[model samples]
Target: MTTTIRNGIMIAAMALALGACASKGAPTSQFDFGPLPAAAPASASSIGAIIVADVTGPAALDTERMHYRLLYSDARQSRPYAYNQWTSTPSQLLTQRIKASLAQAGVKVLSTTDAAASTTVLRMEVEDFAQNFDSATASSGVVRLRASVFRMHRLVDQKTFSRSVPAPSADAAGGARALADASDAVAADLLGWLAALPPSKE
Candidate 1:
């Protein structure tokens, strides 16, 4: 009986030791929090006769400083995710991104200081820049953006674009992860649209 009790204790101790070694650290999902997605190519051809003014913003909503929340199944219930607020103006950052995308599309960006010299001004007015938590059960987040485009001082186009990006809704452990994912989605769509615009003439 004594021998059996001693062996039992020894086996228990060994099991505990093995469990400690096998323990994985905090539960972290293998999720990617990378830059935004890229936009599709625009159908418009390069208009060489016009000088494209770089994309300008603050034209709409200030998303950089906006706080984001995820609403699950019910509209009344929501989970607060990471804050999208930015110290800098959202328009300034957006303009820079737009300029880069235009450059990549072979568009010549006219100087902002020379507004009159620009053959056509690319004005983007942001309307709604906010993240909406549409469904909670599916672990999904939606980003909505409303913008207006101007050409020759006239409203040429206006529309709202919304994207449903995946969010990690496991728990608070993955709140930042989910928000980051949503943010990237928004940025990617915005860049893709900006990139598709036709370049101005040299």
Candidate 2:
């Protein structure tokens, strides 16, 4: 090809790339659910250290994208917010909250990575985690999780906890705050349930 033609093509390609980038605009700002509730009050009896197992859930709820349901449209269909996302998967964030809650309650909390440190394990199965919109003007955050206690690889106790908190606003930020509140409520409930159980078996 002629040098003139080649230079023209290169310039055109560069301009096209620049235009595409500019049209895309700046990246969306990322947001995360707030930290879990403050630690539970200290317990008089010391619970042995326990490891938090990785929480499991469906593909949609298992991800970091903020999910929601439109009750006015398709209550069963789940949708994601393109501009909003979590810092990590919902399960991972919930696991961290649970660990913090337990530790605050005077229980020695170990992470899943520290399996050798404790025989007692707490496994959580997340059932639901999303914002439900009853109308364009109103919404609430909902979270449901089932927790199981295992001692020496054997299931000892299990229970389910669910919570829904009203969103102060109808947008993503409001939904995130409500979800955080719901998560904290669930964590508190789980801690209370664990406190009622007998000490971990050797």
The lDDT per prediction is 0.45, 0.78
Query: By TM-score, how accurate is candidate 1?
Result: 0.48
Candidate 1 backbone clash number: 11
The RMSD (Cα, Å) of candidate 2 is 12.5
lDDT of 1 by residue, 14-128 (tens): 5433432344553323322334345455432453323344333343333333333334323443222232234344455445554554554455566557666655555554443
Residue 87's lDDT in candidate 2: 84
lDDT for position 108 in model 1: 59
Q: Where is model 2 more than 4 Å wrong at Cα?
A: 1-27, 40-46
Error of 1 at 68 (Å): 1.7
Clashing pairs in 2: none
What's the distance in Å from true for residue 115, model 2?
Answer: 2.7
Which 10 consecutive residues of model 2 have the lowest summed lDDT? 15-24
